[model samples]
Target: MSIKDIDDIVVHDISKFRPQEDISLDSTKKKIVEKIKLQLKLNNTSIRKLAEKTGMKHPQILRVTSGENYNIETLIRILDALNLEILIKEKDKNSNDQLMNTAAL
Candidate 1:
């Protein structure tokens, strides 16, 4: 059956749609660091090599790659060195699930 062939479709009210909650910077930063580490591994780069390329300390880079808390500036530098850009957008305030779904998409 085609979508237009359906006779019992219901449309939800957009006014009732909830906005999504924003993710904490810490959680988002951690995810970004992990992704960068994965990409580095795929490129055959070591942790030390990444640190050197980013002009960050080897120990600090290790901590970041291991999911330790680091400053936003440090994270930004690392991402930039990896050719990644951080995009920040104000999230809707009603629904966390919706925000996550949108981000995933």
Candidate 2:
């Protein structure tokens, strides 16, 4: 079945972004989700419009923005709807992780 046919598919788990402090997105993916939420708020974008634009269910987008777990395909669709993209580059020598951040165009 296609994405629409299986829109309810999901597996919930604790976020890897275990806060180092009271509030933080310590993981790269978590940071990206935070960025998406910020952009959506800045642009006054609604989940309804985003779902329509990306052909994804509202719950799917909610899962992503909530920093729950989401597959790459869902993330890509959301990024496309928000005019955003992920950027990858060599990690700094001092950095402990390889994952990078995203940018909005």
Which lDDT values do the candidates have, in the order given? Answer: 0.73, 0.74
Please write out the lDDT profile of model 2 over residues 1-105, one tens digit for every residue. Answer: 998879977746344343333233446667898899888998799987888889889999899988887888999889988999978797575443323222110
Among residues 3 or more apart in sequence or in different chains, the pairs in candidate 1 whose N, CA or C atoms overlap within 3 Å are 19-94, 19-95, 20-95
What are the clashing pairs of model 2? none
- In the range 1-105, model 1's lDDT, one tens digit per residue, is 887868667656542343322344445656777798888878888888888998888998877787777788987888787778888787656655565665554
TM-score of candidate 2 relative to the true fold: 0.64
Best by TM-score: 2
Model 2 C-alpha RMSD to native: 14.3
TM-score of each model, in listed order: 0.58, 0.64
Q: How close is candidate 1 to the true structure, as a TM-score?
A: 0.58
Relative to the true structure, candidate 1 has a C-alpha RMSD (angstroms) of: 11.6
